[model samples]
Target: MGQTSTSLCCIFICFMLAQTVFQVESANILFFFGVSSYSHRLPAWPLVTGLAEKGHNVTFLSPFKAKNPHPKVVDYAPRKFSEWAESWDEMNMFDMRKKGDMYKQWLILPYFGIAMCEKLYSDEEFINWVKSSTYDLVFIDALFNECGYGMAHIFGAKVIQFDTTTVFPWYSSAFGSPDETNWIPDMAYVFGANEVTFQNRLINALIPVGWDLFRSWIYFPQLEEITRTGLSTTDLPTFQDIEKNVSMIFLNTYYSEEFARALPPNMVSIGGIAYVEKRTPLPKDLAAFLEKGNGFIYVSFGTVADLQKMDASTQQAIIGALQSFPELQFVWKLRNDSLLKEFPNGNVYISNWMPQQDILSHPKIKAFITHSGLIGIQESIYNAVPLISFPIFAEQDYNAERVHRNEYGIRLEITTVNQAELEDAISKVVNDSKYDPDFKFTQYSTNDA
Candidate 1:
């Protein structure tokens, strides 16, 4: 009996020691993000929240305020851009529509880069705050050209790149993931060829080589001054080292969304991170509007897609389309008050800010009219609602194209949208058994996958 009791005590001590070791080795992650879009913010929120729940310390750096700040978070707001420059509404849609001129949009990358540099260099308060804190891991959104990669060198920490969309060849190359292929599927199925082509294959090969030379010549000098002490210059990690050093890559897309792509072992697809938490309660008015539902449709052009850019005729056409389908309730998230005032009927409910998640989860929401932003698309998938995708800009075109190709929704390009086409698309999504069932089935399959 005495021997058995002594053995049990030894076993308990071993278990306690193991638990202590694990608690000590657990990661302390610092997340850096360019909160340019709400969609970009959503994907990281769950991961940050999850790490915090596991008792890991997380410090998030962003330009905008966090929607739901966690206790473990250390919010770092960078310098804001000028009002005119910050207004995504003012951005030239015609210019954005142009393809293959990445340098023209180079301004976007630098804008966030400068903002991050300012926070790291000029913001004495933030520098003091970070210097006092300690982190073992750094998670940076790939688009944040300034902070994440640079900080890993400065702090001697392991960096993880978090991609909010499809893994672009340029980024894949930067991570030293082999420049073997470039023909990825088109997020939007516009062109005849696969998303990537022989042309992109050449471009993919050149981008890393060019970027390395460019960074070595131009970017590294500036970064060196900022990161290094006056006596010693810091050595930047090679593209291969960055890739090799990363613990994991988190993708916002699921397997169903990204078909026919080779994913690396380090890459994890936790697509619906935004929907991981229970949704917040809807406002009283919005809740009442949904509760009375004879089956309603939710419409929004997403954050970056300027609904204000739509001509008066287009707005009227959308209103006319909604009016045509009187039996179906319409919950339109309109930015313009004039547009809302034009549709003040009992059947139509209009709000400048609709609780998107709550609205999508509502039982009465039969279909979503979206600009096909990744977040909106994911939400629609999560809710198993059919989509009327009107792609406006960026990957939205790709998202809409995929929705149509997948048979989960209909696509109506903004440039060609008319009242009849809009009405027809909504009607088909609502009444067609094929569309909704396929959407739900795809959702279920994706979840299982």
Candidate 2:
């Protein structure tokens, strides 16, 4: 990416000065977003909520609503956005998972991204809201929503990209973050290292370069059309030019823990900054159920994956695995409490909702069998629980590798999973001495890594 010309620089300077003046007077922040996913939104609450608590005027311009919203933050309701999200989530939730197998996503994502941008722009209420509002800085959720960048420019606000994931090479390239791929593997698909080998290191170094080219060639053209269309008659530089002026980018994971990548000065990591100091108490029934047995293994595939969608074979396998150890208790988190009846194992219990953090905190909760979602992994690590990563797709697969490579746990393949496999994995984690002392965990922190 090239720097904005001298004239563009002057305009940016003037805008920054105006924003600085307004920010000094009273920091007014606007968040333009849609319901990308609950996981993406969860990591941002701390930053947005904390700003509100500290007296910054924050306006959240979507209906993905927050809990106990602070007085200083005003949430705008988008009815159309809600309707669209409902239809989208329902199909993806129930449909046999297709996205996991689609490696040729490059063909669709550009158009998909642009179409989403157009839909948001077409929402009269959303457009009216955007036109009527002004802010010192606009914090945008930037997965497929780069159109928010153009919106930031339209409002003459400084743009801050808010991402609830590890910083990536593509994002880094926009803000001059060095593509330090030698030690820094791609977060999406890690060519990881306990010690970086010559082959792994070389491929890792080359992948990001190919990734950037692939993205720039394919994704950016569609984005240019979306940006220009959104801007209407405004005479300004391409959205690509506007992109480089982004004030900062906030990522969800720690930079130091990110295996040594050089990020842009403006990129900030506020990972887990949203977790409350106090954990809510586990429900009385749950606590009592757990106490009835000596110890229990916890199983959850996180919110994104529905356990109800699990093949009958896998379900039977899980039931058989749990039934074999009648003396050892097991708890599973599912989307519906009714799923418990299907298991029919005396030792197995299920809940639609669970205070996972608080449950993990209990000394009796020996091992966590997880789908390796980022949030679950973070919590498991934070609470020092050994994990059994059973990844389903995308980042879950990457995160499963991370858990295993970090020696926090072992991973199992869900595709070819069998009763014997489940039995062996549970028995190994529960009885084998490997998980007993929790993987000598502190050995892999930033200071040591």
**TM-scores for all predictions:** 0.81, 0.82
Error of model 2, residue 300, in angstroms: 1.8
Q: Across residues 1-449, which tens digit of lDDT does each residue of candidate 2 receive?
A: 24558779889899988876744456879886653655666677667777888788888865466555667778775777766666543433222333344224323444556767777777776776677777889888876567676677777899888876666546656777776766766555554457578887787677667756866776666656665665464564666777888888887665433455666678877665655447777888887888789998998877666766777777777767777877787888877676556545567778877777787778888789997777777666666678888877545656777677667788887655788888888777777786645454442332131
Superposed by TM-score, candidate 1 places the C-alpha of residue 275 at a distance from the truth, in angstroms, of 2.2
**Off by more than 4 A, model 2:** 1-24, 90-102, 105-112, 182-184, 190-218, 255-257, 343-346, 436-449
| Cα RMSDs, all models | 4.8, 10.8
Candidate 1 per-residue lDDT, tens place, 20-113, comes to: 7743456778887753565587777878888888878777776566766778766666554223225555665533543433244543554546
